[model samples]
Target: MKTHALGRGAPQVTEFCLGTMTFGTQTDTADAHRQISMALEAGINFIDTAEAYPVNPISAETAGDTEAIIGEWNAANPGRRGEYVLATKVAGEGLGAIRDGAPISRATILEAVEASLRRLQTDHIDLYQLHWPNRGSYHFRQNWSFDPSGQSRADTMAHMEEVLVTIDELVTAGKIGHFGLSNESAWGTAQWLRMAEDKGLPRVVSIQNEYSLLARLFDTDLAELCVNEEVGLMAFSPLAAGLLTGKYQGGAVPDGSRMAINGNLGGRVSPRVWDAVDAYAGIAQAHGLDLTQMSLAWCKTRPFMGSILFGASSVTQLEHILNGLDLTLSDEVVAEIDAAHKAHPMPY
Candidate 1:
């Protein structure tokens, strides 16, 4: 696996980042640990998890279980902690399980970081991300109804400065190495960079947003911002939540799949989505490529991609992706993908 600089001064991370959202729930502790080991063996040096993880069915009971599971591996493997770059997120507002649904503020970030450190069993986090913007976001299929007219520019700038100050304090105290954002917009990210530059605060290193053949919202504006401003993209849901894996085709929900738990695949199910999957799957078949690997490989080809985050419920699934990490698409195949995307835009 090739490595890329996460941001201006951040550590180098593998193109493929092992995502551990299903660590404690769908996957047991032993299996989760095995996945981590497998990823390391495959030369993957980046791992991402969140405090509000195990999220096929997020709950208060298993809120921090995923981080604890990773912490267990860190505890057991004492000397190999530096083998990989570890990243985790602090949950934003509207999640009842964390901080009683409080918005992300100075106090909330400090509190969340300390708790994340305790659960992760690490003194310093490589990349600490805000799970979502406090004001709200257009991600998670919220763009269709998203409106920013209600937002106050003054309040938003104030919140950004406050968060940046807190992040500065964290870096000074050696709690986090770098800061990032998730589920954010181009405008929001630009303001963060502007504030950091003007105020001499620590600039954001990356943004974790959904980016795949099925979800290309980041391609236009955010893509330009990332490439120009040096903010790398940690693309999540690169497989379109398993839709690109050809698992949910023909309305066949496997017994233990994500579709089984969340029937709509987090609002990704629609008439056009199935057709889009078929088109991409056909492109993979014609080129004799595994769709899962093809989808991931395509993500790596993007200019702003720092790392592509992919999760698996089992070790076997993880192996399938690892075995084909070297797959690269041809020019013809990429053109076909682009054409298919134009034909079936925003399926969800």
Candidate 2:
């Protein structure tokens, strides 16, 4: 495994970040703990979770269970916490289970960080992220119907400033080490960086947007922004929610899989999505490569990639992905992938 600098001053993290979104729901505590140990043994030093995680079904009861599972591991190990950079998020608006769907504010952020700290059983968080912009986001398959006209610029800036002020306070108090964003647009990210620079507040260190062969919303303006501004991209769903693995091809949904749990796989299933998967799978077969490894390996080749985040329901799956950590795609394969993208752009 290789390491990359998260931001200008943040710690170096492995190129592959272990995602624990299913730690409590799809994955049990014992398996989750084993996965953590396995990831560490394999040289992965970055782990990402969210307060509103274990989200196969995403209910209030199991919302913080994932962090608690991780906390249990932290409590047991007690001494190896320093080996990894732990990152979590403060849920933005529209999650009714948390804060009654309230938008992110200074007060909400304070409350969320406290809860996350307690759940993670850690004194400090390496990276604290705003899960999404308060105004709204175009990610999560919302680009089809996204409308930014309803957002007020003055309100948005005010919210950003208030959050920055809170982040500065958190850093001063040693509650969080750095700040980041998720599901944010290029303009929103630039504004955060601009405000941080102008007011001498904490700089935005990273952005964890959805990036993969199927989901390329981050390729245009956001790609340029990350490359120029040094804000690393923690790409989530690097496998397109398992579509790249070809398990869900031909409408065959395996039992206990993400698709079996949630039929749409978060709006990723469509007529064209299967076709796109077939094209990519064909390319993988032609090159005699595992589709999963090929997809993840391609993510590493991007110049702006900081780390590719992946989640597994079982240790077997994790080991399979870990085995391919060193797989590198040749230029010809990458060229073919680009051509496939041009043909089946935005399949979902």
Point to the candidate with the largest lDDT.
2
What C-alpha lDDT, on a 0 to 100 scale, does residue 84 get in candidate 2? 98
> Which residue pairs does candidate 2 place in steric collision?
none
Across residues 1-348, which tens digit of lDDT does each residue of candidate 2 receive?
Answer: 788798778789999999999999889999999999999999999999999898988878888899999999999998999999999999878566766778999889999999999999999999999987899888888999999999999999999999999999999999999999999999999999999999999999999999999999899999999999999999999998899989998778999999999899999998889889999999999999999999999999998998999999999999999999999999999999999999999999
Error of 1 at 168 (Å): 0.7
Cα deviation of 228, candidate 1, in Å:
0.3
Per-residue alpha-carbon lDDT of model 1 for 147-248, expressed as tens digits? 999999999999999999999999999998999999999999999999999999999999999999999999999999999998999999999889999999
RMSD of 2: 0.8
Q: What is the model-wide C-alpha lDDT for candidate 1?
A: 0.92
